[model samples]
Target: MIEIENLRKEYARGGERVVACSVRELRIGRGEQVALRGRSGCGKTTLLNMIAGIVRPSSGRLAVAGTDLTPLGEAARDRFRGRHIGMVFQTFNLLQPFDALENVLLGAVFGGRDGRAAKSRAVELLEKVGLGDRLHHRPNELSVGQMQRVALCRALINGPELILADEPLGNQDPETGAEVLRMLLEIAREEDRTVVMVTHDPESARFMQREIDLTTLRDGEVAA
Candidate 1:
């Protein structure tokens, strides 16, 4: 569940304030899958980051799963995000030195789970994503699709209530992208998790229960 009211994010550039994203009101129900559609620089990613608590809004309210992120400090937000939100980034963001299982275990550890249980969950997730045999492989040793699957497992390892994916399929070929998206949606639905994905592709948007055009929520000029 996500609720937003007069949410606006701005950045200072060239000594002038520039709006990054603005949404007057938006609500997403629990267990819903929504796609945020927009062109480059239209604030899709900005909105996702704000919801993930990676970026603080300049004004207005943002509540995810009943927690108002607008008033929380960075440390508090980080802890909350770790425990309640799962993020799948386009870039994968996996540490090169850590193996696939380690990357996922780190997520559970960050969420304050016990080590043995975390490892078991990580292994289960990796197996669910068809990466059971690749647990010892580092990021560089895996293919693009495999890397993304690993990232997906990492995101789900903590059993987050909300999953935020930014350009999840941006880098893969059509076939691989479709497979990844299918797996993501299927997993989310099976787990009864709420998902909000940022994407510019119309075909990708069709997979979600609802598609929201970010430009429609704009209040002023937005930066790319």
Candidate 2:
């Protein structure tokens, strides 16, 4: 589902070059779940953002679902991401003014889908995530866990083929984090979508089928 070759990101800091991340080659197959594990400043989130097309690589190629992201313009990348990728961020990034269901519908709406059918899909996703009774609640009315669940629903409402989660469980307690991870994996498997998650917790990483330790990769190398 994802392929990267000679991926590298660098920055100019204090008149010196800083390598944020570099991956010589990497491939994540369809319907697979892979966890990217590394310490701070190891480029875990940098790589995730690159895959999401939110950040451009300084060099090399990144392809998702057969489309090379490197050459795509900003607008094209935005459309590509909205169409094929679902991202779950650590912040939950919900809309405060909108209710839970409305928030979920935003996912489909931004993906160029709207109307009754989109609403139905949003409702189904929210209910599936155990938010049926809380559908009318706004972001402020929900707990942290509830808010994250809503975020998950929002990410899946568009039926994306790839899911990118950046520190999905970093805010929750151990039990809640574990539960969320389980729900995420279960839903991804049921939908037959691939997942690439960035996580610090090894226990959480274990839930994925494969693990990529960024520290082990050379400055310009990525493990397959």
Candidate 3:
């Protein structure tokens, strides 16, 4: 579902150029779940952002669902992402002022589905994520688990083909994190969605079928 070749990202740290990722290649197939494991500052998030088309790599190419990401300009990349990519962050990132339903509806807006139907879809997603009862609650009024469920609803509202999660369960307590992860994987599997996740815990990484050691690729090279 996604391919990366000669991907590289560099950053300026302390006035010195540093390579964040120097992966030569990686491929994720449709309906597969891949886990990326690495230490802190191992460039996992950089790679995730690249796959999400939120970052422009210094070199190489990225293709998601067969579209060449590098060639598309930022605007086009964003449009394509809205159509195909769903992202979940460690922090819920929900808008505090908006209720769960409204936050999920925003996903529809990005996909140009802002209408009654869109709202209905959002409601359905919330229900799917077990957030139906909390639809009227704002982020500040919810627990971490509830907020995370809301984020999941928002991410899935637009029917994204590929799911990208960065440290998705890192912030939750062990029990809650397991529940959230189980919920996410079940839905993705049922929908036949491809998922790529960055995680620090080995236990969490084991949940996926494919295991990628980001440190090796970053320290040396990886090929798409």
Top of the candidates by TM-score: 1
TM-score of candidate 2 to 2 decimals = 0.89
TM-score between model 3 and native: 0.89
lDDT of 3 by residue, 1-224 (tens): 98888888987777678887878788889999999888777788888888888888898988899999988889998998899988887676899888999988888888777899888888877786567788899999988777877887778877789988887776678876777788778878998998888888788878888899888776464322
lDDT tens digits by residue: candidate 1, 1-224: 89999999988988888888999999999999999887778788789999999999999999999898998999999998988999988788999999999999888888888588889989988887678899999999999878888888888888899999888787667776787788788988998999998887788889999999888888755564
Comparing 1 with 3 on TM-score, the higher-scoring candidate is 1
Residue 108 deviation, candidate 2, in Å?
0.7
RMSD of each: 1.8, 3.1, 3.0
Pairwise lDDT winner, candidates 1 and 2: 1
TM-score versus the correct structure, for each prediction: 0.92, 0.89, 0.89
Q: Point out where model 2 deviates above 4 Å.
A: 218-224
lDDT (0-100) at residue 78 of candidate 1?
97
Name the 10 consecutive residues with the lowest summed lDDT in model 2: 215-224
* Best candidate according to lDDT: 1
Go through the candidates in order and give each one's C-alpha lDDT: 0.88, 0.86, 0.83
Superpose all Cα atoms of candidate 1 onto the true structure and report the RMSD in Å to 1 decimal.
Answer: 1.8
